[model samples]
Target chain A: MDEKTRRQALKAATLGAAAALASPVAAQMGGSKAQPGGKQDPRSKYPKPPFKSQSQPWPGLASKMNPRPDHGDTSYVGSGRLTGRKALITGGDSGMGRAAAIAFAREGADVAINYLPEEEPDAREVVELIRQAGRKAVALPGDIRTAAFCKDLVAKALAGLGGLDILVCNAARQQSIPSILDVTDEEFDRTMKTNIYAPFWIIRAAVPHLDPGSAIIGTASEQAYNPDGDLYAYAQTKAATMNYVKSLAKQLGPKGIRVNGVAPGPIWTPLQVSGGASQGKLVTFGATAPLGRPGQPAELAGIYVRLAEDDGSYTTGNIYGAGGGQGQP
Target chain B: MRLPLRVLTAGGAALALVAPAFAQGPGSQRTREFVSASAQSDQFEIDEAVTALAQSENPDVRGFATRMIEDHRKTSQALADAVSRSKLAAPPPGIGGDQSMFLSALQSARGSEFDRLYARQQVLAHHAALVTVEVYAASGDDPNLRAVAADTSALIQSHSAMADQLAAKMEEGQARP
Candidate 1:
């Protein structure tokens, strides 16, 4: 055989090997059990979670969910990724904010968590958990929509945590409007202020204090990319958030502060349960993604950690999609 | 005699043809089976959690729970596929071993009682899960498992707060009219 023919045959064999390795059935031929002495293996009986749908809103609170979402406890190991660093997370009472807070703590960063007055209990619990993890956690209660409040929040976080190395803009409120026509000007303004403008202010206030190598991460949404007519205002603001991340990355990159965004497909968080979307539309949430399911906050926690730490140092001006294949890469 | 000779020749050819399958890799079959099993186990737990949440009476809880279930389910499938290809054993189910009891207790309660019990269990479960994730992340050799564990740990921490909030709300609602 000619040299070219031999090379072609080798290439085909390599491709065939790779294809066999990539097959789904290849997974089944592996281990039959996860661990010894644990509960009976659950794979034989239960159906997997379905993919996310464009119309679904956030899934609220993780504790109440059945079978429970994976939250790293015994699995995450700290490598001092953020040793002596400080961070402030808005809407840190519960949900994605809380998850980010814990990840920061695990990485050796001190955190100051902000929540509304009514969400004090939720915020306090997270603060305690942070403390238990051997980090200092400060609980600040206020609304992020107010410029004065945002300023105060930054001040308090600086005072309590000393200085900020990372700023996670994660607080937002959502309400479902039947149509764009049904959305009141007031509602649209409110959503934008809370979701978009608040982050802008927080980043602005926090910028001067941020040192080189600092990072800023905004929690955008899958809705930003795939807009539903009903979520016009919320979706618009989220899109703005994405744009802000891109623009800010360019602006902040010069100062050694990286700006990025996390666009979650559909996550279970308090924002969803507390009227982010109308309850009437909650039941069939996360039903249409290619993966056949929505995602949990726990599932998303690692991406934020990676983004904040050195693991994602080279990554900026990028939006990490944790939406379970809902948004294509 | 001619027919017998032909049958023997056919048998010899068949053996020769199939010999490469057994010679492919040592312990490859076992490893693949293990990974597949582990993935399935993870999916089952995630799915069960979602279904339970969807059926919940509280609209708020149900909504949030449904999302968690969906996300976990998707990740679990990906993990399952990975495990199957790796030929590794699946992780065992019920890390703390009391999920059944908790589920049963939850099933027996009604109204606010059910909510309280469910929320409390979530907190406990997440706390335990966090520990498991931490250990796996630190010691597990598999990059995928470690990544999943690390990410899942952060999420569980968030869930712990949500569970506590729901529990508090349930208590408050019970106290009120």
Candidate 2:
């Protein structure tokens, strides 16, 4: 790690965020055009995917598709909700991870993200966004399949960012199977290790660095409560994740670390396109959501910021449903 | 393996864009000679990935470098074994001109720039190698090299996939906020 380069990147990132957060001196506070006021249908933004099916090999590429999933690259406008905080988000390369990271940096937190070693390109882009927000950004890649890597994931962020205040276990892998009989031992284990095991490993590693005001947010899914027949393994892991949040919250409450989970309904992420869901599933993805469309990643950023903030004091152990009126617990 | 190469593949465009370069595959002599050069390129990437492991703060790139070292070594050995199994003459040492150009440029890069350049090079080199092996696998005069190409093409294609993913993510950072 070049200390000078790291420092420069951080400095550059902070300046970038500062510029985005910078308000025009002449602007009024009541309600500008920047703030949408009247009737607006959130569902009307981006068009849904058509009947076509797509897949990229493992490690999943988000850029190859024709519609290209919207990662909040331009839509998310940040308020200074998490200034100077330090955050480490696993899977921060794309989808929810990327969206949360962009929001965190814009809110003034120095951010570090982790992803699969193969997702470095996406991670680098997130790092650039953080640095653009003028916040320090670092991207780490690793498989959370092992305890050692999970420990190191936190360790690296602590070492790189100088501390850790927010730990978001948002990276997960799901390979949908038609029947329980269709599940291989390895496949079941990978789903468990990535979704359930890794969160435990990461939370355990991140605990020591967290203070009373610190937040640890894990991503659960709408499937936790209302799972489809084909997603037994994934649903089981998510349910476990939700339960784990409650258990950890009970354990960590005395220590001041707020543990929570976010359960997204159908949102357009590489997960669906990358075999987490079937090709048939991708076509109707969020169609069942009450909103009648899949949620965008940008839609989840506010809840993430809220949970990670120092003053988000009232919330803990509870799962926030950012689902488009989908299942909730 | 430099800027434009990385740029081309960042969006999963590597296979489509570089497919043409290997459409005819290299000539028979070049196909026979490719193993030595490909092995050298692996060494080149290993050397570069090692540098990333040591210097990159980004875990993603560091982890990728580790994979590069591990996977390339295994494939290199596989190729060497394939060569030994057949009557093909031993390839000369040290790498070809284009690979050297890539390595020299990689040697000079640092920080995120280094990560970017490294991933780009990996994407280019792997795709080219895939094309080379594929060309030979599909049409080589040497039965042995063709078998080796057939054996190695899958791994090379996978490497290209991994590199393509890496390049894709790195491109996200390039977008002006």
Candidate 3:
């Protein structure tokens, strides 16, 4: 195309995207949702696909996301499944972490959340949601890549929430490098430190404080079983997490503490736009899922809440999947 | 890094873009400056890509050009949203500072000359963006902008590596007298 033609093409492309975005989302599939921050019916099916591929900066902002990934602000309908519990959720700023935070708080748990300093906006939002649940909420912002920070985060969570009955290693980082050669040293280390190392650090620090009946849920992924060729490091760490979760479940079971993993499929989250998936992959994300659309954060909150409560009293060493029928068991 | 918004998020010095606007009065101005600089870079790349698509027959250059247009458009929208929320002036559509000269040179070039020129800027711009976003991420006055800068820097670092490889290949092709 010539300059004039190319300019016209780009102009059309921009306008087209803007035009589509201008259309308002029809109220959630089953009807308009209750004012967010409160509960609605648990079975209300939210809208699917046609979500904006908007990316926020690192540790991306949930608020900025177009049609923001619903963090169970509505449609959760907590049933006091976890009354009087104290929980610490890393990466509770957004995505599954945010959803679980909301579920836990509404289920009657005092909550402490740790996330990257960059995610403070999201953490603040989560804190507000938790406070709305009539539960104590504290935001502990810092990097999870360092052991010192991980230990410090646990201490702060313990201090803020009084005692921690649920320790969720939910924070993670991933980048798609197609070729092994494209994986840089810094990139590899960051993936490891985030997806693997931080879990170890947080678990080690929290183990001493955890009593029997405490739940340690690590956010392993379906990638552990079905690895993506581009996400080499991420898949590797996720695989390792599956093993670690099982091993912890066995070890902690002797102490009445349960360890488990949740393998989420292509849940729509800031993680995708933040380089969790290659851009091309994002163009058709979650299409192959049994369900045509990607899973939302709200879908996973109930499971997290269950595992942390008496509902999961006997569930340990199991990898519960919210993977939309992809990786079962 | 929208400083005014960041300040509001940080719960201090709300939107006070007073005189000495560029000074460190809680980072709103600095955030605006960062956003403007980033917008300038995005526009420069988009213009260069448009030139490449129009003039270059090389499939590689065209592909890279397509990517630049798409990537910049998405990011620009986000930045535009930030600009709107910040109530800051939207940056004019052009290159910043001496970058206009590069855009001019790109507009006039053709064939391998255009290829070489485009790739060189890609290399340089990617590197500059990597550094700029990294600096802002590390110590930018605003917390929110710092996150954007950090995310953008990671992306730029990836793009820079690709541009570096392309620059080397284009330079090799240019050597064939």
Question: Highest TM-score, which number?
Answer: 3
For each prediction in turn, the share of the native Cα contacts (below 8 Å between chains A and B) that it retains comes to 0.02, 0.00, 0.00
- Chain A of candidate 2 scores what in TM-score? 0.88
Q: Which ten residues in a row have the lowest lDDT in candidate 1 chain A?
A: A27-36
Deviating ranges (above 4 Å) for candidate 1: A1-75, B1-177
Candidate 3 structure quality by residue, lDDT tens digits, A1-329: 67566445533443333233232342333422432355544323544433444555566787776656777664455556787799999899999999999888877789998888888877887887787666799898888899998899999999999999998999888776656887899999999999999999999999999988899999989889877666888889989999999998888899999999998988878888777764434533554454444678988998899789977899999898887555545
Model 2 lDDT tens row, B3-34 = 67667567576555555532433336665667
Question: Scoring only the second chain, what is candidate 2's TM-score?
Answer: 0.75
Error of 2 at A2 (Å): 32
Query: Which ten-residue region of model 1 chain B has the weakest summed lDDT?
Result: B92-101
Cα lDDT tens digits, model 2, A183-265, are 89999999889998898898888888787789999999978987766688888899998998899899988998899999998
Error of 3 at A85 (Å): 0.6
Q: Which should have the higher TM-score, number 1 or number 2?
A: 2
Model 1's CAPRI class is incorrect
Instruction: State the lDDT of candidate 3 residue by residue for B59-144, as single tens digits.
Output: 88888889888988877787677656555667644456456546534543445766887899899888877777787788877665
Best by DockQ: 1
In terms of lDDT, which candidate is stronger, 2 or 3? 3
Order of models, best lDDT first: 3, 2, 1
Q: lDDT of each structure?
A: 0.64, 0.74, 0.75
